[model samples]
Structure formats: structure tokens, C-alpha cells
Target: MRKYLILGILLLGSMFSYANVSIRSMETELVAVGISHESIKEAENILNIALKKHRIMLIELEQKELEVNKLLIEDPEKNWFQINRLLDEIGQINANIKKNQLKAQIDVRKFISKDDFLKAIELHQMNLGVIK
Candidate 1:
């Protein structure tokens, strides 16, 4: 009984670990591609309808993982073969999202150049009566 309980805990932990690792990897990839938080936020807001779109995509990915889990349990013999394919497709989608996110970030960075950022700060100060 103890052995079974330990195995169950390990399995549950692994599932969460896999999901977290996938998300972290994607985030790292986006950061490595020179994407910034501000740019990603802007892209999520403007390029997509809103941040909700990104959330929906993440939820869909999680749903696909759940489907994979169900398939594995319901018909391991038949579904086992397809698991790799599904995972591959999911990975590709993640990569695509990362690429698109990086592109959007780059576009946002271009739209707001260094000088523009400085000017915007100055303008804000002027509006706040901090500067003449």
C-alpha cells in the first residue's frame, strides 16, 4: 500500500513538473529571443485581442495534455503510438507561439525607440507639473 501511494505521488508530481517545465522552456526561449516583458504585454494587448487570448491558448494546451492522459488510460495499446505525435504537435505550437511572441516584442520595441521612451517620460513629468 505504501509503495502504491508513493508511486501515485510520483506520477502526480511528474505531471505537474512536465507542464511547468514546458512553460518555463517556452518563456526562456522567448527571453532568449530578446523579448521584453513590456513588449510581450503590448503585443498580447494589441497584436492579439488581449491577454485573454494567450490565457486561452495555454488552457487549450493544458486540455490537450489532459486528453493525452485520458487516452493513455483508456486504451494504452492504441493511444500509446499517438502520444508522441500529439506531444510533437503541441511542442510545435509552443515553438510557434514563442516565435510569434518574439516577433511581436521586436515590433513593439521598434515602435518605441529609446528616444521615444525618454520623451514619453519627459512628457509625463511635464503633465504632472514636475517640469516646465
Candidate 2:
């Protein structure tokens, strides 16, 4: 259980960080790659909407985690039902996060070429501290 919690936190952190960086630098990188202004605007709008949803989900996820931790600390055996429910809620939130991410990707792809989109992603990854 502890390991799963740690892994979930790691995944969420990495994913949100990537999204944050993409929104931060997408315009400049896209422009550098010769993406048109209208396309860049459309892509950014998609990302912004997704990012807002992600932010809310992240907060809710953290709150649920806290609730689960509290239950475990107070009484694992007695709180089994509540803990399991929270776990399910967490799973649903994760699923929604992935869905939102995929939707954002699809929406952005509608207006941006594959190469330019990939370049933006690569740049965002670099911003996230990739070696090069």
C-alpha cells in the first residue's frame, strides 16, 4: 500500500510537472518550429483547459490521500471500508487525469503537426530537467 502511494505520487508529480512546463514554453517553442499563430493559440487553449482540470484533480487527489492516511493512522482494521472507498476515488481521479491528458493531446494534434507537437513535448521534457 505504501509503495503504491509513493508510486502514485511520483507519477502525478511527473505528469503535472510536464504539463506545467508545456504550458509555460509551448508558444515560444511552437513559434520557433514555425507553427502558425492560430495553431499555437488553439494548442495553448487546449492545454490551458486541460491544465485547469488537472490542477483541480490534483488538489482533490491530495485531499483523498490525506483522508486515507488519516484513516490508516487512526485504525486500519476499522477503517477498511472507508479506506477502500477512498482508494477507489483515487483510482477514478487517476483515470480522469489520464483521460484529460489524452483529450488535450488529441485536441492539440488537430491544429499542430506531429513534428511540431513532438518538438514542443521534447522541449518541455528538457525544461523538466532532462539531461539534454
- Index of the highest-lDDT prediction: 2
**Model 2 alpha-carbon miss at residue 27, Å:** 4.2
Per-model TM-score versus the true fold: 0.47, 0.71
Give the Å shift of residue 20 in candidate 2: 6.2
Error of 1 at 80 (Å): 1.6
Top candidate when judged by TM-score against the true structure: 2
lDDT of 2 by residue, 7-90 (tens): 875686577567556645677767777788887777677877787887788789889989998999999999999999999999
